[model samples]
Target: MRDLLGRPADTATLSVTDVDAVLGEVAATTGSGSASRRSELLSDLLSRATAGEQDFLLRLLTGELRQGALEGVMIEAIASATDVPADLVRRAVMFSGDLATTAAAAAAGGQEALLAFGLELGRPVRPMLASPADSLDQAVDGIAEPIVEYKMDGARIQVHRDGDEVHVYTRTLREITRHAAELADLVRGLPCTSVVLDGETLALTDDGRPRPFQETMARFGSTREEQVRALLLRPYFFDCLHLDGTDLLDVPLRSRREALHRVAGEHVIPGEMAPADAAALLESSLDAGHEGVMVKDPDTPYAAGRRGRAWLKVKPSHTLDLVVLAAEWGHGRRTGYLSNLHLGARDPDGGEPIMVGKTFKGLTDELLAWQTRRFPELERGSDDWTVHLRPELVVEIELDGAQTSTRYPGGVALRFARVVRYRPDKDPAEADTIEDVRAMLRG
Candidate 1:
């Protein structure tokens, strides 16, 4: 081991069972009252692991798998290995609500056991996500019909109700029920005994207008109930995943929406179906002080945990393709994420990418996971503040404009920059140059 990896191995042997034992220890110790005892147990496990094994275990422990295979690849592998249909495997995994357990069952009990997995109450399924559309017309162009709704800028929430017990979950499936008892009461009063609702929740003014995103997030994310009492959250239901003892996962959006209207009544999101003109609707939505509009295909099923083209979100903003130079460590809910990104523009003279600004906005947990897994692969080095990476990945950022600044050598800084998406297909060379940004300053 020393000869191959240039690192001395303290342990002579390791096994899969040993790793599992260590995991059990860590899980048990994490909840213990003694901090010193937890640290001692963790340190002991680290000492027992070999260098290579340590790296693998750390990745697994932190949920930062850089092996290039996420759930999609795992499902494909399970299908190939077990001689089961890939679609069936996917459905089973989705229904079972977990990959690890579903794969084990498929491997152990074969198809018979795999077929048993189905939707159950109180167990949260992942929510469907949207892809960004450049314009409202572009969003409605391809679809046979589109449901256009005002896209509120707020927290994505999934509310699950079974009798008197109500659970509210964030987009990441973190249960925040205690912090939102009032919301639970609102849901309890809804016209259903059992239901699952997908929607957005945010602080609204007394006139029923939506507040700023930050103010909403502040109330939604606060641990102190009294501190956030002044800023109350209102929910707007957009989709129904289940209702009245029936599963709606395999049904079309139109059917689910019908159920949503029946169950949520006045709480159903405001929208128009197959409008004669989408541009007018977009203008109205913007004029009504919404972020923009969401254009959804009525024929598509609810694809949990998948970001597909069935739902399109159109936000009005100018975007630029820039390169990621470095990232800083995150905190709180963003603890393990590469939260803050150092953005740079392409040098017109073919030199190194030039730094222009920094941003930590518009990031979802899924995107943060992608960054945590991929950034280390492109790592050049690291200092105390940031993890420097190779300028190989391009990211699209939306900003108000650029301004002259002494902060960066590029002579300008992005005003209120936020990420739109990562551009995997584009190379760093093709990124917008400093000159293009300066042009924005002049414009």
Candidate 2:
């Protein structure tokens, strides 16, 4: 707590990262101890802290919420305060399900006990790889490994059922079983004693295709339950994990696809096992006016936690790696300062960067300050709160995932594209080509 707020004399010198590290180490130390003892310690600590502090502690301890509270920062703070190597702290975390146990175990037992946590809750917890670049070339290169691609829709869900009981988890592994009771009844009819299936839940358009991601997100927060009911969400199964008591994640994509196709039927968003030509698929998708397809390696097993080259999504044309040049003030939590951004990209033919659009959706409070501090250094100048900058950073953006507009230069504008993340490593010259933007406009 002292470290988080930097309460004491010397602690004030500690940076934000230093504070994060201190908290993580405490969590890891407790994780390395007896489970009961660690739990009690966590309970006590949690009780004394305000609800906000508890949330911060949870974010610090768990490896989640990395934008501000990164693992490196957390490790540094803990190591400095507890005098432990950051690596040991990381190893301890991988061993224990929770930080309290991880801290205690690292402090008490060695890696031998830590390595025994291969199977968690009778289901294994593996390092999940992130999805590779959502580009055609990337998908084609992965074809040697038998790739299959599906629609990159909104929600990724995992459904687990043992007899009458059922549990549904979101992509982040949060239990959201209560949020979608309709899905439970749908899963009940499946032909298995116990099963785990991985798929996406999407809001469908009136014509039966999946609706835009915006509609899907908005449906979740609607206070009118009737409105939510009116918005139909169907599960499009792409992979099968557990059939009966057998875990299919180890099975090859072909075997899993066969099993998934057989059981999931129309519910499964079909992906061909054949590694078809990427350009052909891209053309078909663009013509259909739908988001791009996901290319998956047919031989690859279900990578539970990993996003790797095993799967690649090919999005529709008309996206860019634009730099955030300026921002406007926000309301509510962000009362003043740049909350929204005016994005820019390198000149289409080479000159000055043209204004792309503005977005306020992706940034969090902590991220806002981080940007507020960092952007000024890059800032070329400012008109108002909309500060202009030298085009340096690039962001991977997505639209409806294809839409046309005539509001901007280039004789076109983006439909509903928004920031995914800032690509610091990518050079501005490498921002999306104008040809790609034209392809997007065709739709």
Pick by TM-score: which candidate is best? 1
Quickly count the clashes in candidate 2: 38
Error of 2 at 197 (Å): 1.2
Q: Write the per-residue lDDT of candidate 2 for residues 1-443, one digit (tens) a residue.
A: 32233222322233456555544554676444556655555555555455555555566566533344455466556555555666555544542435556555544554444444432332323233346464667666736654455564567777777887777767656666676777777877777667777787877767666665656656555667887787767887877776766767667877888887777788887456564565676566555445667777777765433345776666644457775656665544565556787766567688766666667766766778877777778877776546676677677776653333356665545556666777878887888754455555332
- lDDT tens digits, residues 228-330, model 1? 7778788889999889899897899999999999999988877888988777878887776677789999999987655477999887786899999999888
- Candidate achieving the largest lDDT: 1
Runs in model 1 deviating more than 4 A are 1-7, 10-18, 21-50, 58-68, 223-226, 320-396, 399-443
lDDT agreement with native, every candidate:
0.82, 0.62
| TM accuracy, model 2 | 0.58
| TM-score of each candidate structure, all chains considered together | 0.69, 0.58
- The local distance difference test score of model 1 is 0.82
